[model samples]
Target: MIAATPPANATIASTGAAGETASKLDAIAAQIEAANQRISSNAASIETAAKRLNTLEDTLDSTRKGSENGLIVLAKADQRLADIQAQIDATKQTQTTGAEAIANVARRVDSIEMAIAKSAAQASQHETVSAITGKSADTASQPALAAISQQTSEPQPRIASAVPAQTGGHITAPDTAKPAGDRANDAARTDLRIAEVEQALAFNKAADINTAKLVAELQAQVSATQQTVAGNTDVIAGTTKRMDTLDASMARMDARIADGERSLTANVATDSDVAKLVAELQASLASLDKRLAGDEQSLTDNSAADAETRIRVGALEAGTAAIAGTTGQLQAENKDQGKRITSLEAGLASVSATAKEALDRAIAAGKLAEGKLLFETVLSEAVAEFAFDKATLPKAAKVELKTLAEKLKAENQNVYIEIQGHTDNVGGTAGNMALGQERAEAVMTYLNSEFGIPLHRMSALSYGESRPVADNKTKSGRAQNRRVVLVVLK
Candidate 1:
C-alpha cells in the first residue's frame, strides 16, 4: 500500500520560531475576541429592542382597557338616562290620573250641592203656597228626598256619593230645572193658586188655624234647607278650586316629561357619537394589535438570530482555546522539530513519486461527476447498409459487437460500455438527433441481447452531426461521419 504523506514539513529554526507561532496564535485569538465583541454588541441591541417592544405592548394593553372602560361607562349612562325618563313618564301619567279623579270628585260634590239647593228652593216655594192657602196647621211633614246625581261623561243621573241620607223636606212638585225665570214662573203660578185657596180657607176658621201651623212648620223647614245648601255650596267650591290646582300641577308634570324626553333623545344622540368614537378607537386598537404582533414576531426572529450568533461565538471561543492549546504544544515540540522535519522530508520524496495516479483518480472523479468521463478504450465500425431510416443493426455490425462483448465479459463487473451514434447533417437538427439516437439504441440492444450485458452496464448516447470527425460537405465524409463508436471504461 502507498503510505500517507504530510503536505509539508516544518522546522523549528533557530530564528525565534516558537515566538513567531505564538504571535500568529495571539493574532487569531485577537480576531476571535473582536468577533465576540461584535456579537455581544448586536445582542445588546437586540435586547434593547425587545424591552422597547414589551413596553409598547404594555402601553397598548393599558390603552385598550381604558377605551373599554369608557365604552362601558357610556353604555351605563345611557341606560340610566333611559330608566330615569321612564320613571318621569310614569309619574306624569300618575299625576294625570289623579287630577282626573279629583275633577270627578269635585263634579260629584257640585252635583250634590246643586241638587240640594234646587230641592230646598222648590220646597220653600211649596211651603209658601201652603202658607198662603191657609191649610190645616196639623199637616204632616213630607219625607225628605234628594235629587238625581249627575255623571261627567254620561248625561244619566245616579245616586250622589256625597249626598246625605236625610234632608229637611221634599216639595210636592220638584222642578227638574233650576233656571231663575222658570222657577219664578212656577212660583208665581203656585202663588196665584195659593191666593184662591186662602180666600176659600178664610171662611173656615179650622183650616186657617191648620194653615198657620203648616206655614210655621214650612218656614222652619225652608230655613233649615237654605242653611244646609249654603254650607254644601262652600264645600263644593273649595273642591272645584282644588281640582283646578291639581290640573295645573298635572300640566306642569306633562311639560317636565316632554323636557325629559327631549333630554333623553339628546343623550341618545350623544351616545351615538360616543359609539362612533369607540369604533374609531377599536380600529386604532386593531391596527396597534397588528403592529404589536409584528413586533413580537420580529423579537422572536431577532432572538433566534442572537442565539445563532451566540452559538457561533461559542464555537469561536472553543476554536481560540484549541488554537491556544496547539500553540502550547507547538512550543513544547519546537526543540525536536528539526529532526522530525528531516525524517518527514525523506519519506515525502517516495510518496510524491506515486501521487500521480491518486491525483488522476481524483481528477477523473470530478470529470465523471460532470458527465465528461472520457472513454479509455474506443472501438468503431461502419454499419453496412441499413434500409433508409431503419434502426435495425447491420449483420456485420452485430457480429463485430458480439465478438467485442465476449471479450468484455472476460473482464470484471467494473467494466462499463458507451455506444455513440453519429449522423450526417442531412436534415433538420431535430431529425438528425432522432436518427442518431435510434442508431445508438439499436447497437446497445444488440450488445445486451447477444452478450448478456446488463442494460445498466451500457449507456447509449447520440452525437448527431455536432461532433463529426469528418467533414459533412462530401459524400465520402458523410459516409464516414455516419458511424457508431463503442467505448469501454472502468
Candidate 2:
C-alpha cells in the first residue's frame, strides 16, 4: 500500500479557500471600522443631547425662581392694597362723624339767633302800646313795671333797675292827670319788657360772641378735615391705580409663564432626542457584546484547528524519521506523503467551511447586519454543565443547551457544532479524558435528540485538564475547569 495517499486537487482547493477567507476578513475589518466610526458619531450626538437637556433643566429651574419671586411681589402688593383700603375706610368714618358735629354746632347757633330776634320783637310791641296810652298810665305803670319784671323772656343785666332803691338813690314819680288802668298796665308792661329786652340783648350778644368763636373753630376743623380727606383720597386713588397696574403686570407674568409652559410642552424633540441617544447606546453595547463573542470563538477555533494540524504534521515527520537507509523507496514515499499533506490540510480547512460559506452568502445577499460580526469568524457560545468529578449533564445545563439549540435553529443556516468537555486534574490523564469525552457526548446526544442536528455536523472533543480557563488551585477554579462548551460555527 502507498501509505494511503490523499487527493492532489486538495492544495488548489485550499489556496482558493484561503484567498476567499482573506478577502472576507479584510471586508469584515473594514466594516468594523465603519461601525466604530458610526458609534463614535452617535456618542457625540448623545453628549450633545445631554447638554441640551441640562440646559432645559436649568431654564426650568430659573423660571421657577422667577415665578416664586413674582408671587412674593404680588403678595406684597396685595398687602399694600389692603392697608390703603383700610385707611380709606377709616377716613370715611371720620368724615361722617365730623360732618355730624358741624351740623349740631350750626343748629345751636340758629337757635340762639332766633331767641334774640323774639326778644327784640316783644320789646318793640310793648313800647308801641305804652306810647299810644300817653301820660295817664304813669302812676299805674310804676308798680306794674316793678312787678312785671319777674314774668319775661329777658334775663337780668345786672345794670340799673327801672325803679331805683330809696336807701342810696333818688327816684322821680311821673305826673298823672287821671287814674287810667288800661294805660297804666300797658306802660308798666312796656317798661318791664324794655328792661328785659335790653338784658336779653346783652346776654344774647355775649352768647353770640362765644357761638361765633365756636363756629370759627368748628369751621376751621371742618376745613382741615376736608383737606385731610382730600389728601387721603388722592393718596388712595394713587395707591388704587398702582395696585391695578401691579395686577396687570402680574397677569402678564402669569400669561408669560403659561406661554413658557406651552412652549416646553410643544418642544418634545428635546426629550425624544435624549431617549433616542440612550437607545442607540444600548444598541451599540449589544452589538459590541455580539462582536466580542464572535471574535473570541474564532480565536478558540483557530487555535484548536492549528493544534490538530501541527499534531498531524508532527506524526508524518516522525513516521519518516527512519527512512534514510531506503532512500530510493523513501523518495517515492515522500511523493505519496506530499499528497497526504494536502488531504490533512483540506480536512482542517473543511472545519471552517460552514462559516466561510455563510459569510460569503451574507455578503452576496446584502443581508449583512451592521455590528453583528466584527470580523470573519465563527459564531460560538459555551454552556458549562459538568460537576466536580461527574460526567453527567444537569437539568439546568440541559435547559441552557435547549435554549441555545433554539437559537441555532432560528439561524436556519449551515452550521458546524463543536462540544468541548474539560475536567480538573483530580485524576489520571486517561481517566480524565474518558470522563471529558463522556460529558461531551452527553451534550451531543441532547442536541441530536432535541433539534435533529446531523451527527456528522457535530463533533465532541475532550480537553481533560490540559485546557483550563481558570486556575485549578482553588475550588471555584477547579469547578470552572470541569465544564463543557457548545460552539457553533457559521
Candidate 3:
C-alpha cells in the first residue's frame, strides 16, 4: 500500500524453488518405498535361510540317531542268524542218527525172516518122516508080508521050528526078540527127529516174536524221525525266508542311506547357493540401510509393516499346532472306539455260538421240536420229577438220573447243572418264591444223594412266578409254567 511495487525476479525465483523442492520430495518418497521393499525381501530371505539351517541341523541329527539304531539292529540280526545256524546243525545231526537206526532195524528184520524160513523147512521134513513111518508100520502088520519075509529068511525057519514045540501057538518070544532091536532103533530115530523139530519150531517162534518187536520199534522210530524231519524242514524254510526278508530290509536301508547321502549333497549345494543369495541380500540390505539413513523419515512405515507380518506368522504357527493337537485327539478316540466295537462283536459272536449249540443239543435230545415243546412233559422225562412236597426221588427216577450221571462222568465233562424251580401264579409272590426254592432244593438233594452226583456240580435256584413261559390265566399254561428245569452251565 505504501509503494505497491513488486520485483519480477523475486517472484520467478520463489516459484522455481518451490517446484524443485516438491520434485525432490517425490523422488525421495519413491526411493524410500524401493528401500523398504528391498528390506522386506531381505528380511523374508533371511527368515527362509534361518529355517533351512534349522532343517539341516535336524536332518543331520536324525540321520546320526538312525544310523546308530541301525547298527544296533544289525548286530542283533547277526546274533539271531548264528543261533539259527546252530539249530540247523543240531537238527542235521539228529537226522543222521535216526537214519542209521532205521538201517540197523532193516538188517534185523531180514535175519528174522531167514530164521523163520529155516524152521518151516525142518517142520515139513518131520511131517514127511511121520507119514513114511505110519505106512511102513501098516505094511509090517500085514500077515501076507510077514509070511513072505519069514520064508525068504533062513534064520526065520529055525525060529519057526523052535516055536512049534509050544502047544497051539507060534514062537512068539523069539519072534518078538527078533524085532526088538530094530524097533528100538526106529523109536530112537523118531524121538531124535521129534526133538529136532521141536527145537527148530521153538527157535522159529522166538525169531518171529523178535522180528515183530523189531518191526514195531522200527515203525515208531521211523514215524518219530519223519516228524522231526518235517519240523526241521519247516524251521529251515522259515529261517531262510526270514533271512531273505532281513537281507531285503538291509538292502532297502542301504538304498535309503544312499538316497539320503545324495539328498545331503544336494542340500549342501543348495545351502552354498543360499549362502551366496544371503550374501547378496546382505549387501543389498547394507546399501538399503545406507540409503535409508539418508532418508530416515521412511523407516516408520517399514517397521510397522514388519511388526504386522510377525503377528500374522505367530498366529499361523499357533493355528497349525492347534490343528495337530485336535487331529491327535481324534485319532486316539477313533482307536478306542474301534477296539470297543471289536470287543462287542466278539462277545456277541460267542453268545450266538453258545445259544446255537444249546438249541442243537435240545433238539437232538428230542426235548424240542421246531422251537416248541411240552415243557413240563420234556422236563419230567429227561429229569427227575418231584411232587409239590416230596423230597425223595422214585427208584425209576433215580435209575434214569444215575444213567445221566454216569454218562457225564464217562465223558469227563465238568457240568454245573442248575435245577431251576418255577411255579404257577396260584399263591402270593412270597409264598410262591418259598415253594419254588423248596422244590429246587429237594430235586438238587435227591440228585446228589441218589445218583452220587457231587453237590458242587449242582445248584438250586428259584425263579418263582417271575419268569413265566406261558399264560398264568389258563390251566394248561399254568401246568406248563409250574416246572423244574435243568440248565447246563458252561
Candidate 4:
C-alpha cells in the first residue's frame, strides 16, 4: 500500500506539468492575435498613403496638360503674328510701287503741258505774221496755223504716248511756211519753253525723290518694329520651353518624394510589426527557457524512479524542440525584415541624393536663369477655379502657394518675383484689366502674408485678356486663360 501511494504522487506531478504547458500555449496564441491586429492597422495606413500618392499624381498630370496647351497656344500666336507682319510688308511694297507709277504719270503730264504752251506761242507768232503781210500772208500761213491748232488740240493720250520716245530732247516738227528769221525766232522760243518744262520736271523729280526717301524711312521703322516683335516672341518661346523643363523636373521630384514616403511608411510599419513580433517571441522564449530549465532538474530527479515521468519529460522536450524551431524561424524573419528595412532606407536615401544632384546640376548649368521661369502651376482644378472678379484665395490655391513659398525659401536667393495675372476675353477691356489686377494683388498679398515673402520682393501686374494662353471662344480655353504667371529675376 505504501509503494502504490508514491506512484500515485508521481502521476499527480505529471498532470500538473501538462496543465502548465497548456497555459503557456494559450498565452502564445493570444500574442499571435495581437500581432495580426497590428499588421492590419499598418496595412490600412499603407493603403491611405497610396491613395494620397494617386491623388498627387493626378493633380500633377493635369498641371502638365495645361502647360502643354499653353505652349501650343503660344506657338500658334507666334505664327499668326508672323503672318500679319508679312501682310504688312506686302502692303508697304504695293504702296511703294503705286507711288512710283504716279510719279511717272505726273512727269508725263508736265511735259505735255509744256508742249501745249509752245504750240500756242507758235500759233500766236503765225497770227502776227498774217497781220503784217495782210491777205497774202494770211493765205500763206493759214495751213501752218491750222496745223498748229490741230497739234495743240491733240488729246493728252497722244502726248503721253509720244513723250517717252522723245523725252531725250525737245520735240520738233519742221515748218516750210515760215521765213528763216521767223523760224530762228520760233526755235529760240521753243528752246525757252523746253527749258521751263525741264525745270518743272526737275522739281517733280526732286519731289518724287523726297517721297521715296520718306517711304524708305517708314519701311525701315516698320521693319524695326517687326524685329522687336520677333525678339519678344523668341523670348516668350524660350520662357515656355524653360517652364516645360521645370515642370518635368518638378513632376519627377514629386514622384520620387512620393516613392520615398511610401517606402518610409512601409519601413516604419514593417519595423514596428517586426519589433512587436520580436518582443512577443523573446518573451515566449524566456518563459519557455525558464520552464525547460525547471523541467530538466525535475527530469534528473524523477527519471530513475518513474517511467511515466521520463515519458512526460520526453514530451516536454519535444514541445521545447518545436518552440525552439519556431523561435529560430521568427529570428530569421526578423533578420530578413531588418535587411529589407535597411535596403528600403538606402533606396530612399538614394532617391533624395539623386534629386539633390539633379537640382545642383541644373543650378550649375544656369538652367535656372535670371528672369527665367522658376515654377508654374495651375491655380486649381476645373471644378475649383479661381474666384472670378474677386480677390480671394481657394484652399487649393493656398496649397500651391505654400509649395511655392517653400521652394523660394529653399533657394534662399536675392530674387524679385513678377506676378502676372491674365484672363479670358469675356468682358470689356477695362473690366478684365481690373479683374486681373485684383487676382494678381491677391496672390502677391497671400505670398507676403502667409509665406513671409517681402512685398518689395514681388510686383503684381495685369495683362488683362491681351496675353491669353488659349483662345477665348471655347469654355475650356477660357478656363485655361484665367491663370497667373510667376517670373523670377535676380
State TM-scores per candidate: 0.26, 0.30, 0.24, 0.37
Backbone clash pairs for candidate 4 read none
Model 2: weakest 10-residue lDDT segment is 373-382
lDDT of 2 by residue, 1-490 (tens): 0011121233334434556555655665665565566556655655665575566557557655655665565566556556555655655565565555445534433443454445446545655677888655454555544343343334323322221111222212222322345435644644554455455446545655766575666666556656756665676666567657766765765676566556554444554555576566567657655655655565556545543544455455344434334445645778765444544333224323433544454455544443132211111112243555676777756666666677667877666656666677898999999988998898889889877888876777787777654456875456545766554544
In what order do the candidates fall by TM-score, top score first?
Answer: 4, 2, 1, 3
Task: Candidate 3: give the clashing pairs.
Answer: none
Candidate 3: 10-residue stretch with minimal lDDT: 1-10
Give RMSD (Å) of candidate 1 vs. truth: 29.6
Checking candidate 1 for backbone clashes, the offending pairs are 135-210, 135-211, 136-210, 137-210
Q: Give per-residue lDDT, candidate 4, residue 359.
A: 42
After superposition, which runs of candidate 4 have C-alpha atoms over 4 Å from their true positions?
1-24, 51-55, 58-66, 135-141, 154-276, 279-490
Tens digit per residue, CA lDDT, model 3, 336-367: 53342333233233333433555455556554
TM-score: model 4 vs. ground truth:
0.37
| 377-488: candidate 1 lDDT, tens digit per residue | 2222222344445567777566556666676666543565566666778888888888889988988887777777888767777777776544578654465556665655
lDDT of 4: 0.60
Better of 1 and 4 by lDDT: 4
**lDDT scores of the candidates, listed in order:** 0.51, 0.53, 0.50, 0.60
lDDT at 448, model 2: 93
RMSD of every prediction: 29.6, 18.9, 51.5, 42.6
Instruction: Score residue 245 of candidate 4 by CA lDDT.
Output: 78
| Per-model tally of clashing residue pairs | 4, 1, 0, 0
